[model samples]
Target: MKLYNDTNAFGLVSRANHWISAFLFIGLIALGIYMHELPKSPEKFELYDLHKSLGIGLFVLMMLRLVWLKISPNPEQISHNRFEHILAHSVKGILYLAMIMMPISGWIMSNSGGHEVAFFNLFTLPNLVGENETVHEIAEGIHGTMGPLMILVIALHIAGALKHHLIYKDNTLKRMLGKK
Candidate 1:
């Protein structure tokens, strides 16, 4: 597979980034939901730390992905319908926004709650804000709201890809899959 995008299809780098980010997002979302109800204990704390670490990892990966996109432009959308094209772009924009917002909000939430975000126990990340219950609550609310909403947005993204592949019989999904 090619490393850079052509006019018709995505390259290996884009496909790798997309698939890695997709799996990470899904794992983080599932972990977030599952660990929410765990009773307070060592295990819960461990899981929360894991979640924060993974979130930070995702943030770093996304920053790198953005840089990669700038250096290697993505393939054009294959949709012929203007509305479908617009909607596809809109959903993608929202996904990118969420990818950035979720991690920052989580970092703020952790810092404001007087918690250190340890990355896989390798090192601690710098605090973004001083301890403040109000800020903590607000950030918490944003993170909480974004998590569930992300599920819906991700569903829409996947559904759109499937629609293009199955219903429209286009190269939209194939391009992302690194196929011609």
Candidate 2:
């Protein structure tokens, strides 16, 4: 199995992170939406805890992806045109930015609200800010607004990938798979 990406395809590590992160992110979005409709109860708290924990995992994965993408550059461009290349690059940039910021905003919101997010119950993240209602409120707002935007960008990214796969009939999406 390939361990690194080439001009034509992604390697094992990148594919692993990409697929795992995608699944986790989908779960997170689903959980977030579900949790909103849930009544105040232990189950709701459990869902929140699960969502936060998985989010931390996704954040770490995104960080690693950024570093990996930098060091292990693709051999060639999959994008056929300047516009496709630019748009794809922009989408990826926004996706990474949103991924990094979402967890951070959630962390700030939790910390300011005096609610701790324990990662898989293994350990709790450090609270960087003091418990302040205003900070908590602001962070909540940022997190709330960012979620839909993230989803929108992700949807567009998926559409672009599908276009490459079904319409373009290229290896763009195949490169992300375990095998090309």
Candidate 3:
């Protein structure tokens, strides 16, 4: 199987990482929204637990992706214009920033709320921040707000990729999709 990305396409591993992270991010958002809407009940608790679990999972995947990105070179730029290049890089940078920060903020919020964060009913994550009502409230607000922003960013990213694929007929989407 392909191990490293080429100029025209991403490798198998990168594609897998990208898609897995995408699915997990979407799942976490859905669970979080549902949890927020639910009344104070055991079902809400369960949804929160699932949200925490998925957040931790996404964090792990993001860390792995960082390592992979550093070690394995990615496809070269498809745009020659400096403006386009900057825009492309900025979009990716924001996505990476959100992916890294969102889960960290969630963990801190949970810890501040004195909630136990578990990973798929496997192991419990240690609290990063001490319990405090104010901290919990602030962190929860930030964490909750960041989720929708991330969704927007991801949507823009996908739109740009599709534009490259269907309109510009460039290799941007193909590179990410592992196509040649």
Candidate 4:
């Protein structure tokens, strides 16, 4: 496969970014949900640290994806229907926003809650803001709400992709898969 995107199909970098981010994103969601119910313990703390580290990794990956997109533009939408194209674009926009918002909000929540966000225990990210209850609560609220909404949007995206491949019999999925 080509290493950069072209008008006809996604290239190696884009596909790699998409699949890796998908895996990490889904893993983060599962990890977050599983950890939520855990009682206070050393294991819970370690899990939280892992979650934070993974989240930071995701944030970095997304930012890199954005840069890669700028460097190598994406293929055109396979759908000719205006509504379908618009809807797909909208869902993708929300996904991108969520990808960015989730991690930053989590970091803000952590920092404002007086917790250091260590990236895989190698180093701690600098706090976005000084410790403040209001900031903490606001970040927490955003993180909580965005998490579910992100899941919904992700589901919609997957469904749309399936619709394109299974029903429309188009190259929407194949293009991303680097298939002709």
Candidate 5:
């Protein structure tokens, strides 16, 4: 297996980033959902802090993933025609936007709510937006509204992978899995 992308397959690094981002994104969403329901308490606040920190980490990962995507060679589609290609590209574009934007909106909400994001408790990120209730509400609206939608897009992405693997029996999914 190659360590870098070629025409037919994704490289190890891309696969690594993709999988890691997926895992973290799922975990963060789950945590966010659960955290919102918890009663006011120390543990709840701690959980919120952790969630915020993980979100900031996700933002960092998105940046690095974007950089890696730009530097790496583009992988080719297995058997996509114009329509399928366009659909796949559209889904991917939206997914990328969600990945980048969700964390940012969350961060904006945090800062607007007068919260400092501590990345893994290592250091506190600067409060960029400060305390703005209107901004906080808007950001929270975006964050909450987009979360479920992103999950739906994620499901579609997975369905596409399954279609490629089970129905088409192509290496499309395997290529992303770093398989030959």
Candidate 6:
């Protein structure tokens, strides 16, 4: 199968990216939740460090995906219904927004907390903002609160995919499943 989208369906690369991102997104949420629940200790701090690393990795992957999407043509519109098309597009847009914002907020929070952010222990990310207790608190609040919202939106996205695959029995989901 092709790895780039053409006119009929998603390419293998697109499907691969989607599934990889889905798994990573879920893992990130779980890690974030676990870190939040853990008592303040060395272990908690370690987990947070790993979480920060994963966030950086995710951000890089998302940037690559965005560039790929811009250059690779998308699958043809499967639904002619205006409402369905609008809903689909809206969900995609929101998903993209979440993907972009989540990492940024996390990075900002870390910077404001005077923490060094690293990616896979290979390279350090320079702090983009200066340390400020108030800014740190606000950024942390946003990062924590946005977690549940991300989960909700992800659930909706998955539900919509299932609706297309099982209920509607359309190619909409299959297109992203690497089916022609």
* Tens digit of per-residue lDDT, candidate 2, span 1-180: 778877777788888988898888777877888898999999999989999999999999998988998978755658888998999999988877888888999999999999997899999998879899999999999988888777888999999999999999987787777545
Ranking by lDDT: 4, 1, 2, 5, 6, 3
Please identify which of the two predictions, 4 or 5, would achieve the higher TM-score against the true structure.
4
Candidate 5 Cα errors over 4 Å, as ranges? none
lDDT tens readout by residue for model 5, 147-174: 8888888888899899999998999888
What TM-score do all the candidates reach, one by one?
A: 0.96, 0.93, 0.92, 0.96, 0.94, 0.93
lDDT of each: 0.90, 0.86, 0.83, 0.90, 0.85, 0.84
lDDT of 3 by residue, 99-136 (tens): 88889888889889888788988899887888999999
Query: What does each candidate score in C-alpha RMSD?
Result: 1.0, 1.5, 1.5, 1.0, 1.3, 1.4
After superposition, the stretches of candidate 1 with alpha carbons farther than 4 Å from their true spots are none
Candidate 4 lDDT, 5-86, residue by residue in tens: 8888899998998998898888888888888889999999899999999999999999999999899988887876899899
- Residues 1-180 of candidate 1: C-alpha lDDT, one tens digit per residue: 589877777888889889998998999999999899898999998999989988988898899889988988887778768998898899999989988999999999999999999899899988999999999999999999999999999999999999989998988888787666
Q: Comparing 2 and 5 by lDDT, which wins?
A: 2
Residue pairs that clash (backbone atoms under 3 angstroms), model 4: none
Q: Write the number of the candidate with greater TM-score, choosing between 4 and 6.
A: 4
Report the number of clashing residue pairs per model: 0, 0, 0, 0, 0, 0
